[model samples]
Target: MMYKNSILLGTIGGYRDRFHQFQKDRSLEERLEIAKTIPRTHGVEPVYPQDLGADGSGAAAVKASGLAVSAVNVNIKTEPKFRDGSFTSTDAGLRAETVQYIKTAMDLAADLGTDMITVCPLIDGWDYAFQADHQKQWGWTIEAFAAATAHRSDVKVSIEYKAYESRNHIVMPTMAKTLHLCDRVGAPNLGVTMDVGHALIAGECPAAELAIAHDAGRLFYVHFNDNDRGADWDMLPASVHLWQTLETLHYMRRIGYDGWVAYDVFTRTGDNVEAIASTFEIMEDLEKILDKLGQDTIESIIASGMPQQGYRDLVKGLL
Candidate 1:
């Protein structure tokens, strides 16, 4: 049950927000080539429409690049019409289009020889109180997922929940709520993509979040990145929450998450390639450290349930 380490190809290109552009842009071919040169990451994920359009050129480029397709990241946020909301949009037509687009994304994932797709409903939330009808939007979200899951049973559709970003409060802000969405939708293919940074910003321990999703048997994919408690900065792994990331890695192995452990890191001044490659190196180092500590010792510490400072002493070894 080894995890497949991967990188979201978008992180290596020019990163821009409303305020500034992080780096110069690179073509899809260039991004793919750069990814192939990095160590420990044998898989690369590309975005839908933006990177891999319906024209099949992007898919062909990925196949030609020789790196495995970890998962196809469907773009549900960048489009203009989806600015206000996507699945939870007040416009019925926009909601329906989003569901159809998800189905199309699943099709593309299958075409690219993968069975998983990660989606983040980034633009689907509210900015202020009473801005959205909670009940109706929740129902629409359920309906959209139901339709997409019904369209295909072979492909796994995973939702990436962010605490907040473009909107003040996102509709699916937590993994528990997201699993409820899966419950309401009742789709076997539907699951959760536990982004560590998102979980941290939501005030939840990444290890605890992993335990919950894994217990529910809805853990489909994973995104790895560290962040300060207040913001999802997408910093290199273990940069801030070293302890939590270590605990999460233990839980990830315990749950047997044999999917691509992709990254969502963004660098404004540093070299994006170096940042991503070093991120993977850190993860590998953490896993090796765990080996040094021994899983039996850590599990015994957890089972002890002792505020007896059981595994707390292990941090000294890491330092």
Candidate 2:
């Protein structure tokens, strides 16, 4: 099948973490200006409220940079109040506050001209067994999301699932669990952001997860990064698991995913611009490799169901 390649590229504004040595904290505008300098990126994702600046200056700066607003990330784990949990908190008052916060963020996302908002429940799970009430917490989590999207169905909420980060464990830790949450929430606008690093850490096939979410019609967004199967270091994409990342890209093309593919790399040292540019360069190379592999060859391999034959041809092409 002849396919036209078209995908909007984006990056998280805060991925440019400042290291005490080489990098320093840059204002939101400065970061956005840096993002615009990246050739492949057409947009920058800024976290709501904090990254929006005091008087819409941050959003204005992004606008002035001629880059699109990919999405606004709603941070639920960073604040002290959400240490236990936010959406599924047993503290009713805290849950109320969390719901209100999301609503406010939703409004901000609309104002930013991007209907997408990412919700990463990084603190919504327990580290130990018997620490969380499974049924009750599940209900609360679903209710909070439902309430957030009830008023405005147009604003899509994409939940980014990570196995763990802030807490020893995170709630809704996998695509299957996340898609189940979306179903339970029963909101048309509720979807998911499939982060490749998280998928690798979760021991999941990134390509399969992408296909699953798309089949469910809940694949709202994507974040591309790589990590050793051990931890979410948020390294450059295709850095660790080359073949798996390539296969993931293959499936992305197979499904005709034209949505935003955001680079979600983070660093505590080294030049952030170079890191981002390097990822873009790697992506350019991967795209060329993918072009050479072609959908027809991949399809034939899948059809044959014989791994050795496919491997032989793939090795020949590489050499």
Candidate 3:
């Protein structure tokens, strides 16, 4: 089967912490070479500033790693809190700092030939009170980001959402809310970074969510991983919702989503490259399944209201 758009398949840099034990202290350049060696890899490598540090030096290190800075995940709080309305004057100040940091990262990403950055609102811990604080600062963060990204058309912003893991545990954390935040901020470059693991945790089908985002035209980036009803984030793909993973990819193909498929997994051991590659291979196999299933049959199954069974049969037939 011939794929049309160039899908940017890459792993997050944090994988180094998992794969190489003694190489943990390796410079960003060395780590990046390992990351860049992966097949069909592209896009800017993701840097978690809180884990790595936020100075300009971090950005320089990302560039030196031979990987473009695809995006960065900035931690909003050092510790998790259960209360809301925690947006102290200090909190606002920290928000400002985050905006400035994003601007710097965008500049560096541009220099390194990447154009996307992800900003997470808050860490896990805040309850409804935290949601309230998020609602309050949401507007400010968007406005600040819009202004920061106004001059840089190539750089886009994605809001990463999670349920219960890192605060803001709403019964249903919808992309609609995320898109609402972007609309309120009124930034053309802002979009949603849909993480399939979170969607499953929220008890929503990842494929349906992708369809919704595609219909609304708000999807910008994607995080590929799997989770079972009892599992937490970063679980292996095949172990959790194997069919849904394939269905999600089929839906992405139908919607023509040509963004990066970022592996955002965190394991206890940290050598997730094998797992990451396995996940990619699963996705690739799913692609071939879709090729054999054909668009008409796939669409018919999606339209037939038997998505789960139909998708499973489709995969079974392919195998």
Candidate with maximal TM-score:
1
Return whichever of 1 and 3 wins on TM-score: 1
Report the C-alpha displacement of residue 245, candidate 3, in angstroms: 1.1
lDDT for each residue of candidate 3 in 1-319, tens digit (9 for 90 to 100): 2222111222333333333632134455555666665565564444545434565466666666555445665444443331232222136655556566667767655665666777555442345654345444555555665766675778886777666654545322567677666677677787887888877876778888888877766787788777775534576654568778877877787777766767655554545555555655666776877788788887787689876888586757676
Across residues 1-319, which tens digit of lDDT does each residue of candidate 1 receive?
A: 2899888989999998789998889999999989988988779889987899855468889888888888889888888888888899888999998888888888888988899888999888888888889999888999999999999899999999998987889989999999999988888899999999999999998899889988888999889998887888889988998888889999988877777889999998879999998888888899998887788888887888845577575755565
Best by lDDT: 1
Model 3 TM-score is 0.78
Model 3 is weakest, by summed lDDT over 10 consecutive residues, at 1-10
* Candidate order (lDDT): 1, 2, 3
lDDT of each: 0.88, 0.78, 0.60
Candidate 2 Cα outliers beyond 4 Å, as residue runs? 1-22, 53-57
Clashing pairs in 2: none
> Candidate 1, residue 145: CA error in Å?
0.4
